[model samples]
Target: MSVKGIQPIVSEYHLLWEALQHYQERLEKFSSMSTDEDQQLKYDEKLQDMDGLLRSIKLAAKNDYQLDLK
Candidate 1:
């Protein structure tokens, strides 16, 4: 019962999957809140950040690169 021969890219994919889940939870909570204009702007920014991260993750999966998070 040993885990071996795992590649870096696969490890990164797992990390990104966890991060995506965390962000999605945050996004859902934010969406449920009633916020002022400034707060709404902040939420928008957060959503954008999540979107960008998701896009990068997709690209990394497409290219099979673990370092693409840079």
Candidate 2:
């Protein structure tokens, strides 16, 4: 594939990374919630989303593209 085609994927990877980071912060807040059941559910969902994003990042990296989350 052309470098041009890879550009959009790279952009998407960056967006997903940003979203994962945000979800992580939300997860921390959820952990501190007094409501156990509801907060735990939200935290679990966020964790799953973060895992999915990480997996996507790994797959993109395997394609020899730089995600560069930093």
Give the clashing residue pairs of candidate 1, or none: none
lDDT of 1 by residue, 1-70 (tens): 0123333466767686677868877876776584676776777788878877677666655566534443
TM match of model 1 to true structure = 0.61
User: Could you give me the TM-score of model 2 versus the true structure?
Assistant: 0.53
Clashing pairs in 2: none
CA RMSD of each candidate after superposition: 8.0, 4.6
lDDT values, one for every candidate: 0.65, 0.67
Task: Report the C-alpha lDDT of model 2 over 1-70, residue by residue, as the tens digit.
Answer: 3344453467666676677778787787876674788868878877787777677565655565754455
Candidate 2 lDDT at 37 equals 84
Candidate 1 residues lying further than 4 Å off, grouped into runs, are 1-8, 65-70
Give me the overall lDDT of model 1: 0.65
**Candidate number with greatest TM-score:** 1
TM-score of each: 0.61, 0.53
